[model samples]
Target: MANTTSAKKATRKIARRTEVNKSRRSRVRGFIRKVEEAIASGDQALAQAALKAAQPELMRAATKGVLHANTASRKVSRLASRVKSLSA
Candidate 1:
C-alpha cells in the first residue's frame, strides 16, 4: 500500500518498532505480575523487593512511550501503598 520507497521503509520501521514495544509492554507486565504474586503470597519482603525492581522498569516504559506517565505513576503509587500496608 505504500506508494513511495520511503513510505515502504517507514512501514518496515513501524513494524519493527511495534515488535519492540510489544516486548517492552510484556516485560513490564511480567514485572508487575511478580510483584502481585509476591503480595498475594503474603511475603512482605519479597513484595517490597519486587516493587523496588519494578518501579524503574515501569517508569522506563512510560518514558519510552509504552505507557502514559500518569498511568505509570498511579500504578507505582498504588503498589507502593500496598507494600507499605503489608509492612505496617
Candidate 2:
C-alpha cells in the first residue's frame, strides 16, 4: 500500500530492479553450470574454455552487486581448481 506518489514510484523501481537482478543472477548461474557440465563430462579443454568465459561473467555479477566480491572469488577459485583436477 504505497500511498504517496514517491512511494509508488519507488515500488515500481524496485520491481524493475528486482527483475534485472534476477536475470543477472540466472545468467551467472547458467555460466557456472556450463563450466560444471564441461568438467563433469571430463573434457578438460571445454572445461577450461567454460571457466574462461564464466570468470568474467562472475566478476561482472559481483561488480553489479548481484554477488559479493569474496563469494564470486571463492566460486571462481573452486571452479578453477575443479577444472585443474579434471586435467590430472
Candidate 3:
C-alpha cells in the first residue's frame, strides 16, 4: 500500500522499530516476572535482589519509550514497597 518510495522506507523503519520495541518490552516483562516469582517464593533476599535488578530495566524501558514514565514510576514504587515489607 506504500506507493511512494518515502512511504515504503517509512514502513520498513516502522517494522524495524516495532521489532526492537517488542524485544525490549518482552525483556522488561521478564524482569518483572522474575521479581514477582521471587516475591511469591517468599525469599526476601532474592526478591530484593530481583527488584533491584528490575528497577533499572523498567526505567530503561520507559526511557526508550516502551512504557510511560508515570507507569514505570508507579510499578517501581509498589515493588520497592513490597520488597521493603519483606523481612531480611
Choose the strongest candidate by lDDT: 2
The list of candidate 2 runs beyond 4 A from truth reads: none
Q: For model 2, what is the C-alpha lDDT against the true structure? A: 0.97
Winner of 2 and 3 under lDDT: 2
Global fold similarity of model 2 (TM-score) = 0.98
> In model 1, which runs have C-alpha deviations exceeding 4 angstroms?
none
lDDT tens digits, residues 1-88, model 3? Answer: 9999999999999999999999999999999999999988989999999999999999999999999999999999999888878784
TM-score of each: 0.96, 0.98, 0.96
Q: Model 1, 3-62: lDDT tens per residue?
A: 999999999999999999999999999999999999899899999999999999999999
Q: What's the best-to-worst order under lDDT?
A: 2, 1, 3
RMSD of each: 0.8, 0.5, 1.1
1-88 in candidate 2: lDDT tens per residue?
9999999999999999999999999999999999999998999999999999999999999999999999999999999999999867
Ranking, TM-score, top scorer first? 2, 1, 3
Q: Note the Cα lDDT for every prediction shown.
A: 0.96, 0.97, 0.94
Model 3 error, position 1 (Å) = 0.9
In candidate 1, which residue pairs clash?
Answer: none
